[model samples]
Target: MIPTTDDPIGDNPALIVIDPQQTTSESEEAMSSGAASIPGGRDAVMENINTVVEHARSADIPIIWGKELHRPDFADYGAEIESCEPEHGIVGTRAEQFDPILSIDEDDMEPAEYVIVKRRYNFFHRTDIEHILRTYDIDTVILVGFMTNICVHYTAHGAHEHDYAFRVAEQATAAPSQDLHETGLKCMRYLQPRGIQDITDITARLEEYDGNQLVKRVKESGQITPKTGPV
Candidate 1:
């Protein structure tokens, strides 16, 4: 459901952009035919992803970018080495870097933090994501990026297990196929009723984030003074 005026997705929140890396030419051959191509291609969701990023920036919300990088020696490959392409997301490779089309900047990692270096689909796995979230006092996370069925889906499970509420910006993510994309969203919604949401709703909630303090004040003291000016 879309967040309402009363049920705003308040409380401190962070944006976790999962594996927005460049796909390699050999990547398509590693997947089955059913999962070989994105419905409208990856660029279809780029606009939505950028829009969400813009809104998150304007709201002053912390933006954490997740990059999947595997060691050159393949020591971190584990079970994935058998099922996936070895060259995918290799360290020092273009695939390990964020897509230039993204709105990412050095400031996002200004203090040399918030960028999650992960080797697994789940960003919270063996990464500092949990500590980062706690450090920022973030209770909710807004997810956006590539492979909605893989990285994004597993990351949502990780967040749920870590006790952090999350919402997937439906239009801001894409999987290899439409069916898999919908399936991923369905599974997440089963975990959290309002987990799957539109980009519009996500942006709207972010724009009103400053009002969260007012909500907290009302709950703490049974009274609220109307503010006539900007929050």
Candidate 2:
């Protein structure tokens, strides 16, 4: 079921932008097979993503950017599974950089915002992303960015396992094809089921709560008690 306006899950959600980097040859091959590509290509999706970023920045919400980076040696099996290899120069290369159109200036990025580098599709896999969220005491995660079916979808699924209240910005994420994009969204909706609202609704919900105040509420309400689990 879609979460309501009164649902505390959507309050003070962190924006997770995934794999907004320049496309590689391997990535293009994956796209041609109807598996992964930024829906409507880079130009169209980046525009919408920029708008999401601007809104999040204006609201002072935490924005976590995720990218896939491989080491010089193919020591990381996760990269191989995702078809991101150093031989192909898919990761740890200039092509792995965020698209320039997004205006992601390092200087302008807030200190609270995190840039997580992962070797796999799931941002939480073998990464410190979940720990960072736990440290900040964030519950909700608003997912955005490229190749909707792959990185973005995997990250959202991982969030579900971690019990994070999550939503995906429909317009802000794209796949190589319409079928894959819709399929990914449907899968995410099935998994979490609760916080599947659009970006517009999400932004409106976030506007109701000031930054960090929602965390305070969750703490006071005892929704997040002393737990030893990853959450």
- Residue 56, model 1: lDDT of 75
Instruction: List, residue by residue over 1-231, the lDDT tens digit for candidate 2.
Output: 223454533744778888787666655555432332334555767787788777776665667888876665657644355553223325556656777888687666554667888877888898998776866667788888866777788898888888777788777787766787788888887887764566676666666656664334344564334556686
lDDT of 1 by residue, 147-226 (tens): 77788889989988888778888878877666887788888888887777777888998887773343344344533454
Candidate 2 achieves a global lDDT of: 0.68
Q: Which pairs of residues collide in model 2?
A: 37-176, 39-175
Give the range where candidate 2 is weakest over 10 consecutive residues by summed lDDT.
31-40
Q: Which has the greatest lDDT?
A: 1
lDDT for each of the candidates? Answer: 0.71, 0.68
Q: Which candidate is the best by TM-score?
A: 1
Candidate 1 error regions (>4 Å):
1-10, 28-40, 84-87, 107-113, 211-231
